[model samples]
Target chain A: MPQPVIAAVGSSPVGRTDFPGRDLFSLALEEAFEGLPDPAELADAVYVGNQSEQYEHQIMHGTLLAEWAGLRNVPAERVEGCAAAGALALRHAAKDVRNGEHEGVLACGVEKMTAGGTGGATDALSAAFDRAIEQRSGVTAPSQYALLAQRYLHETDATEEDLAEIAVKNHRNAAKNPRAQFSDEIDTDTVLESPPVAPPLKLYDCAPVGDGAAVALVTTAAVADELGVPWVTVAGTGTAANNIAVAERNMTEIEGAAVAAESAYEEAGLEPEDVDVAEVHDAFTVSEALLSEAAGFAPTGYGYQSYLPPESREAGWTDVSLSPSGGLKARGHPIGATGILQAIEAYEQLTGVAGDRAVPGAETALLLNEGGVADAVTVAHVLTAGTEVAR
Target chain B: MSGEDRLDVDSPLTLPGFFSALADGDLLAGVCADCGEVLLPPRPACYGCGSRNVDVEPQPKTGEIYSYTAVHTPPPALEDDAPYTIAVVELDSGGRLTGRVDANYDAVGIGDPVELGTRALTDEERSLALEHELEWPLHVFEPV
Candidate 1:
């Protein structure tokens, strides 16, 4: 069986837009096929991932996006798993291609969070939590992460300064990303002085709400060679879920990320040391710290110490880069669009298309996507430039 | 002035109709007969085994703190009394419940022994008061 290769990846300019005549599905579809070499050719099928219909007020988004993208009458399906929506879509598409059901497939992810105001958006996002237990008890995302942050602080020597460093670094990286929501340069003092949304988590510690879409074109390696297209192969993908409520699990540990990374590594036949670059889910500063530990980039509770100081990056610590695309913090998190955006970033970095913030000589890149509070569900994927899989 | 002037009190001694049997000073938890897993908050179904055969049973109220956090910002109703500890208490029957910790920050830690207690409440004239409120049941954990 021939492995599927991502032939092309495209994304909308990921910043706050008026979105007057355009909806999320429309905007994403336009971006997906924007620069296709052959506009007449259509994907054999389409896979769309969206978290909530309540947020978009549009139910059947898969069909709507397919029609809007001018690929109507093709088989289209939508997959939802909280924040893991995009990864799930890719997984389905990969399966279809691997099974010879489809020659080429299109996987797109979009979220119109700004369509709903803050309160409504929050309610939609909170639907990912256990309605009977966590949500009813007023355990929102920030509150759950706040508890984790408290426990993490107690167990580790990490301080507020360490978290601020991560914010500063990502923000600096985002300044180079034209599509990032926060393009300004932020420093450690600015991050630390920001008002606390939840204890130990300042306002800058959270990823911002924005609207965007990302799409990838996946085809067989044989098709890629025939079409004369530059391609990066999907080495492996893994996903896992943990308890919805933080009280039910150990707050200091991210079991879901660990499990997902292990499966992905096993499938790719690669170890943590093999990854040259990573686009981690840093929805919150503490999340970056804990997830880094969980993904085996650093020891447990010591992820905060892994921050490459601004001076250190200038002094050549950029070899092993994390979030060169500004990440969720600076890149803006549109919920459903996050996982797909990570894929696009990985595609860009691996192909040396990341412009100014590109990682040098990047061969193996891993993208980790997380959804829900306290690291509830996590999806990880490893992408490589070479065709290691035998056709 | 009539309705607004009435004194309002929220107490841990309060037991709702669902938990009226607990007013007798016995602890209660909703247990699923099918899977034999006890659940806190007394739900109607068993999440573990996905069984709807659940019944409320009296159990011991003693437990230990599995984990805890000092909440500096309380809910709007509890803003005045800021900086309270909320904990997940693991019961003797291997069940866990989240409630307020009735100890100072330094005194409380993970795996600390705790016992459940109720807050006493008083009504007007100290005569017409019911034993407790029926809606808001407060469960506090004190260092054992």
Candidate 2:
């Protein structure tokens, strides 16, 4: 079957902002309808992906967003898979098109975080874990990932310096992305000298908490052709889940992302070598190295090694062109909206519209979105600008 | 305020039983009777095998830290306890539990031996919980 194609993509700038009277759904609607000729007349269904309703004090956002966006009575619902909620929603919308359920589906993710300060936001994000157990022990996002980083460093030859390089590299990339939350470049000395949030995880190691939304319009291949809009084929998509508690699974292996990416690569009939540009979640600096290994881009115990210098591609170390959109590190993570943003980045890079940060002559792309600690729920997708499915 | 501020002790996995056992001088874990997989927080069912036949087994209190972090930034509820060490200790029974490790922040490291201990909620912590409408585990781990 011809797969669904992402017809259009849009997003709001990612940063820490207090948009006084604006609500979550409206933020989503504004970004979703951006640049569309007549967005109100184009959708058959809406899928809203959000991780925490506690942040906005609202629920049932799918129907709420659809109604607010002037979609009227069309089918609309929300899907949750923690941080990967947006990717999961996009996958569902794509399947809807592929199965002939809806010719077009609007998939978007939005999170309004400033309503609650760091404390409120931290508590809300904690909802992703096994609440009664994990949250009760004072394990917040940084603490959870800190454990993973400690274990990863202990077992591997990689050092904290390698992880710092990742932050430096991502910030450099984000400097070229106008929408990113952080664009300033810092060296390993700065990263190492930064205040420690969780031991081994300095302030620079974490993604900033921010408010944003990202949207993608997916439609049947026929509809995309008829609309005559610039689009990218959703060549493949896969998702998987893992134990909710960090203690239950192997800390070193990102089992969820591995499982999801394997299926995604297989379905796309492509391998790691075939990917030209890729974006993997890097909510924490450690996450980038962990996910790089999980996504098969780097050898086990050597994910951090890939980030080090030959120092440029001409140097000697392998040129792993990862996270060109700044990633969650410098780009900011608005939770629900993050996954869709990855899709938007994929669309931009593949379509040659990624401005200064664009990868030259990029063709094939991969996007990975992860949720919760060690990516308990992960979604992976492969995209191409080509009109036809090569497989 | 009395100890009445505690989390509901009746739920299947409220872990009140686990904390109660610690106060009674024992560490407990739920072991599946059919598959022999041990679970922390005492689940009603076996996650490894589809079996509801589970037993609350006494666990070895001492274990080596599998991983750890000295938390400098904490949630509002844990603000008072900022710079506390949180570690995931792999118990001798093979069940891992995430808990606070009562040690000097820079002194603790991965693989350090630790043992279960009960922590009476401080008046400040209790007030914070009351203020935030939060529930916290009333237990911790200490260097053994």
Q: For candidate 2, what is the DockQ-based docking class?
A: medium
| Native contacts recovered, each model | 0.04, 0.68
TM-score of each: 0.79, 0.91
DockQ of 1: 0.10
Backbone N/Cα/C clashes per model: 0, 0
> Per-residue CA lDDT of candidate 1, range B1-144, in tens?
257533232111222533444445656777889988876656555767888677767778898887665554333333444456667778888887666677765578877899976543222212322344423234577889
Any runs in candidate 2 off by more than 4 Å, and if so which? Answer: A20-35, A309-320, A387-391, B1-16, B124-137
Model 1, A158-177: lDDT tens digits are 89888888888899989988
Off by over 4 Å in 1: A20-22, A37-40, A309-319, A387-391, B1-144
Question: Which candidate number has the best DockQ?
Answer: 2
lDDT of each: 0.71, 0.80
